[model samples]
Target: MIILLVLTVISIIASLYASFIYAPTELVMGDIQRIFYFHMGTVWVATVAFTTVFIASIMFLKSGKRKWDILALSSAEIGVLFITLTIITGSIWAKPIWGTWWTWDPQLTTTFILWILYIVYLILRSVAGDNVKQARFAAVFSIIAFIDLPLVYISARLKRGISPVVFGPGGGGIESKMLITMLITFLACTLLFIILLKQRILYEKIKDNLRLLKSRAI
Candidate 1:
């Protein structure tokens, strides 16, 4: 864990340098385009986090294990954090380019929905507490929420929207330097996610232990 933390810190510093110093300013959007690297990184991490939640939720359902539930909850919490960052960074980048803080573009709409769904999942988990039946319900909801993940990815391609499709037809490819920077940012974000998830899970376990001790004392 100590080594992981050290590596994550180093990766984050390198990513910042790569984004701000190594990557060239875009001819079109100028320095504002620099936010793109961080934006993509957050998006990538959120995608992984939520996918982890989905899988963990499924595992909990099949195995009926509290650890899996803890994993799902921890991942969901971090997933929400990263998606929140994604939205904020996206809005920051969108303001100058789109002439507004936000728009009801397809990708944005789906992304918003995706965010809301996980928010609801987190709420459900909190309300359920340690109840097995309620936890199962939350798990099932998470599985259903995975459906929106794909919708968020495809919305810009299938519908007329303002979000840029960067990886497919009708998309503009990234420059090599910018691509490298983006990849480094992704590495930083992923490492940060792993660290956060580990801490969160440990915290949850400690909390449970405290609760158990209090009950026994009572």
Candidate 2:
């Protein structure tokens, strides 16, 4: 864990340098296009978060373990936080480039749906009352809801080439420097997600222990 923290800090610093300094300005959108570095970082991490939830949910279903439930919830919480970041950053980038705050574009619409589904997953965890029942419902619902994750990811590709794609046609023919910067930023985001997910799982464990203690004490 200590080594992971050190590596995470280094990666983030390197990513910032690469995004702001090493990467060249885009001829089309100028420096504003630089938003892609961090924006796409959030998108990548959010995708990871949902994938973690999906896998953890599957494990809980198979093993019927409380820890797996805790992991799924932890991942869902971080996933929600990061997806919110993605939407906000996308809107900020959109305003200057697209001259609008939002459009019901295919990817955007699917991302919105993905966000709402996980939000509902979190709510379900709270409302279920019984821990076992809550875990069961959350696991099943997440498995079902995860279907849209792939939809959100490939929305641009799946479109009939009618709308403009964000990362269009062979990864937008990006320069090597820009691609490297984005990849570094994505790695930093992945490390951050891992750290946060671990901390969140620990928090849930402590909360559960407290509840158990209180019931026994009473």
Candidate 3:
């Protein structure tokens, strides 16, 4: 908990300073482009959370550890928070740049679908009733749902008439300073995610322990 708190504080300070001081003001978008730091940051965190959940689910299935189950749940819950923020921030940025609050663009559509899919996963967990059933069902669904992420990323690039390029590649048209700011934002958000995940897992552990103790007392 102390580590999480410390990291959270550091992340906020670093992210804000990097965005204001290190990042260059965009000429075309002006100060409004400042939102890019948050927009990209949230999305980066969401993506990492989703990936972690997917991998952790697989590990849970293989190892059958209750701790992995807790991790999976924590990650999914945090992923939802970040993804929701990503969609909202992206919409805000889009309204100014794209002139619409939303577009049926492949990227947006895929992200929206992924968000809904995870929401359903959460609902399934609520209805499953028992730990065994919930873990099995959610783990399976997480793996299947994450399969769409790559497709979503690929479709976005294909739709834009740009072949998929690995990170840090040339010809992407992103300026070096913008890229650096994005990297900084990504790092900050990643740290924030670790903090949030730890707190959530600790909370879940406490809640579960309380429930078990209550059952025993009864």
Candidate 4:
């Protein structure tokens, strides 16, 4: 835990140096374009979180293990947190470039949909009440929801929009220094995700143990 915390702090400082000092300011967007560093970083971590949920959900369905269920739920919680950051930061980044708070752009819309879907997933877990049923339902829903991940990634390509493409084929125009900063920030965010996910899973385990103890006492 200490190691994870230390690494996260170091990465964060390095990422800040890389973003603010290393990268050149854009002529059009200016310094606010620096938001892209952490914005894309959050989005990348959120994507990883959801992907973990998808894989853990599948494993839970196959093995019916309580540990897998815990992992799926933890990943979903972390995913929601990161995705929310992504949306908020993206909005802030968008305002200057797009000259508005929001537009019904394809990429934006798809990302919102993905966020809502996972929020719904979190709700389903809480409202379902029965632990076994909740886990089963969430596992299935997580698997279904992940179908949108790739779609979200490709949304810009499928539809022309004000949103820029930053990855995959046909994606270019980013300078080398900016790219390096983004990569470092992305790594830092990944480490943050690891710390957050580990903490979340540990919390879930403790909660389960407490609930089990209460039942035994009864």
Candidate 5:
């Protein structure tokens, strides 16, 4: 854990350097484009985090394990945090270019919906508390929420909007340096996610143990 934390810190520093100093400024967007690296990083982490929640939820349903429930809850909370950051960073970048903080572009619309769905999932989890049946219902809802994840990506392509497609068909590819910087940022974000998830799971387990102790005392 210590090694991972140290490495994550170094990688984040490298990512910061790469984003601001190594990558060349975009001819069109100028310095504002630097936010793209951070935006992409957050969105990537959020995608991974939510996917973990989806898979963990499935496992929890199948095996009825507290560990899987802990994992799902941990991932969902981190996923929501990162997705919120994605929206904020995207809005910051969009303001100068699109001349607005927000618009109901297809990608944005779907992302907003995705965010709301997860928020609802979290609420369900909180309300369920220690109720096994309610928790299972929340898990089922999470599985259904997973559907929106892919839609957020495809919405940009299927319905062209203010969001620029940086990859795939109808998109302009990034320069090699910019691509490298993006990869570094992704690495940093991924490591951060892993660290946070592990800590969160550990914390949840501790809470569970304490609850068990209190119940025994009662």
Candidate 6:
């Protein structure tokens, strides 16, 4: 736990300093574009975390192990946190570039849908009576819902109507420095995700132990 916390802190500091010092400021979009670093970082990390949740769910079902369920649950929670930030920051970036607060762009739309699905997954877990049943059901839903993510990306890229490609190979815009900063941010966020996942899993183990102790006391 201490190691994970320390790593997270170090990564956060390094990411912030790197973005400020190493990353070049955008000439076209100006300082406002700096938000992309954290924004894309959050998105990239969240996507990976969520994908892990789906994979963990599958493993849990096959193995029927409580630890796998705990991992899936932790991943889902962290995934939501990162996805929330991704949406908010992306919206902020969109306002200046696209001249709107929100749009039904392919990426945004798919993200929003995936967000809702996870929200439902949480709700389902809360309402379930038995731990085993809850884990089983939620795992199923998680696996099914995550399948939409790749499709969302592909569809967004192929269709290309409302969603604007802000930065990338085909975007036709963006400075090299801005891109570097975004990549750095993404790497930092990935590191943060690893740290958080470890912490959450540890917490789950502690909770399970407490539950066992309480039941014995009763």
The sequence of per-residue lDDT tens digits that candidate 3 reaches over residues 186-215 is: 877888888889888999889889989999
* lDDT-superior candidate, 3 or 6: 6
Name the better of 2 and 6 by lDDT: 2
Q: How does residue 5 of candidate 3 score in lDDT? A: 73
lDDT of 6 by residue, 97-201 (tens): 778878776767888898899888877766763568776998999999998778667766676754556654446565677666666677678878888898899
User: How many backbone clashes does every candidate have?
Assistant: 0, 0, 0, 0, 0, 0
Candidate 5 or 2, higher lDDT: 5
Q: Give the Cα lDDT of each candidate.
A: 0.94, 0.87, 0.79, 0.88, 0.96, 0.80
RMSD per candidate (Å) reads: 1.0, 2.0, 2.6, 1.2, 0.6, 2.2
Tell me the lDDT of candidate 1. 0.94
Candidate 6: where are CA atoms >4 Å away?
Answer: 1-4, 161-176
Worst 10 residues of 1 by lDDT: 160-169
Best-matching candidate per TM-score = 5
- Error (Å) of candidate 3 at residue 170 is 8.9
lDDT digits (tens) for residues 1-218 of candidate 2? 99999999999999999988999998977888788889989999998999999999999999998888889989999999999999998888878877887888788898899999999999998787566876698789999989999998588777632223546663456788998999999999999999999899899889989999999999
lDDT by residue (1-218, candidate 1, tens digit) is: 99999999999999999999999999978999899999999999999999999999999999999999999999999999999999999999989987888899889999999999999999999999989999999999999998999899888878857667778776778899998998999999999999999999999999999999999999
What TM-score does candidate 3 reach? 0.90
TM-scores of the models, in the order given? 0.97, 0.93, 0.90, 0.96, 0.99, 0.89
Q: How well is each residue in 65-142 modelled by candidate 5, as lDDT tens digits? A: 988988999999999999999999999999999999999989999999999999999999999999999999999999
lDDT of 2 at 120: 96
Candidate 3: C-alpha lDDT: 0.79
Candidate 2 clashes between residue pairs 3 or more apart in a chain or in different chains: none
